[model samples]
Target: MDRNALLVGGAVGVVVVAAVTAVLVPGVLADPTDEGPIRPGPVDVADVSIAAGPATGETVTLGIETRIDHRGNPTQNVSVLVRAIDAESGLLATTQRVDVGNISRDGETTAATNLTVPREGGYDIEVALYREAERVDQAKRSVSGVSAIKPPYLQSTTSFTDTEALPPVSYSIEDAGEDRTTLDLTATLTNTGDEPAEDLSVTFVLRQAESNIVASRTTVDAGTISAGRTDSVDATATVPSGYNYYIDAVLMRDGVVIDTARGAANLNPTRTISVNQTTEDVELRVEDFEDDDDRTPEDYESERTRTESSAPGFGVVVALVALLATALVARRWRQ
Candidate 1:
């Protein structure tokens, strides 16, 4: 055979051998079984909120927020969008979810969105929240999308009428005998919206404006707050120091933060009650004051964040000396 003909013939023979090997390899291969669990996608459902106005032509914004879990823990990759839906038509409308774009997740997020209408009008805006899975609930390659727009808000779904807006929070701390402090704080949280917040938790974090958290405690498990009804969750956290310090109260539901209010651990002996769904804080200093304590005011410390509060007085003195030296130099130059 010629050189070119020989090369071509050799390639043809190799092709024939590969075809035969492929035909035999299928019969020789073993059956493969998947040993992994069936992984499901992310939860689509999330709580939503709407702002209502008395007069027409008012701008309305719908915010959708959800908690997505991966491997049974909350994931922060969730995104939300709003869409226009025919109120009574039960029809799949346009892909309007793209207009709103994705909202950023701030640590754990609560979004406030504004959707401007054409005129003073009201239509059922079907909002959708999307979640992208980095690693899905199951150990497998997956993608997911769920929708929970029909459900009410996660923390609160209703609004309060004019009459039911509880009074502001009022509280004070009193000396409960020696080396003990009792903080009496009161607030009323009414079920403003339609749905109920289950496992509603209210915690009071008493922090010193000068120091970090001098004392704190979870005040209420507050069962199920009924719709349109108001309930109170007031607690007295006993600590060692006089509540000369002040801090704010934080409200959380299902390990999620919702609202916070200005609170004062005032050294007030007067007893008071906060009527509104808010908090009242008070503090009382001891009649006899001594300055020789070297430990934390209380032992039942939940969380302590030490900041740059109590800096040594030496720094202040040095700053004063530098200022004096600068002034003396200016005076000599003028002379």
Candidate 2:
């Protein structure tokens, strides 16, 4: 081959080899189990509430409240970013990033963040929902600035809004004392929310059965309790006699009803009696009658005369004939 032709042939062969290697080596060396990035599904954001917006000079800390809903597929490595923009100047005032680890398919989450804005002005808050690097949804709202010196309304206010459901409470009644007709109503309060519970009060009502009349009522305050913690309180109430009774327990926080529990109690003591029937025969025996030895001679003679007068004439004749026959036989033996 000529020099130029040989060089071209060598280059062609090298290119062909490189192409084959590129196609086959990847398939042969690549692990079949190595999968690529996961595609996330749709997400929805709604119900954004600005809980607090206390501003101090140029810096304002925003309390953003919102709910995130995941749909269709589960997502991992999710995050949320909130931005405060000055609507007049189109300037961004603050930004906050929240790391939402994972959300299951069709699941929902409530997110709250306190973002510190570096400027003081009227702004519109924007929330961007993301799964990894992709933005799935966005929401925005406008809010007024608040004073930093004063306490946040969301923290100072005693309302059930945004508060978790109260833990369950169970009530039981036991004797308070032996000398009195009073009972101790015990209420066990449990905290099921992820946050602390405060300003809790429980009201116990002991009512007569099937009647609205309250026999005894008392309220007990159970102070602050941590999440998943259990606390209890006792109240003394007089239980009346001769009537069935029940108990109604109400759990409250900031004058809002968190939970309610009801139970019945049997106050009147009682006894039970059972009667049964059986089939069986019984027998009786009597002793033979004997004459009294202590009887006087006059009494015995009177008794004998009455007996002789009452006897049958045939019985008397037979007795006399037997005696005479016995005497005759004895006399003949003697002769």
Tens digit of lDDT per residue, candidate 2, span 215-266?
Answer: 6788988777778766667677776544445677877766656556665555
Identify the leading candidate in terms of lDDT.
Answer: 2
lDDT tens digits, residues 1-335, model 1? 69999999999999999779879786443336744554333344334545532222222334333333223334444555555443445343332333222333323334444444323223455555555533222111111111222222233542222233454345665546666667687655667667775677677666543334445555666567777777767777666554444445566666665666655554434433222222344443432232235335552242232323335543777789889999999999999
lDDT of 2 at 15: 90
- Model 2 steric clash pairs: none
Number of the predicted model whose TM-score against the real structure is largest? 1
Over 4 Å off, model 1: 1-155, 158-168, 172-175, 268-335
TM-score of each: 0.34, 0.32
Error of 2 at 239 (Å): 76
Clashes of 2: 0
Hey, what RMSD does candidate 2 come out at? Answer: 28.2
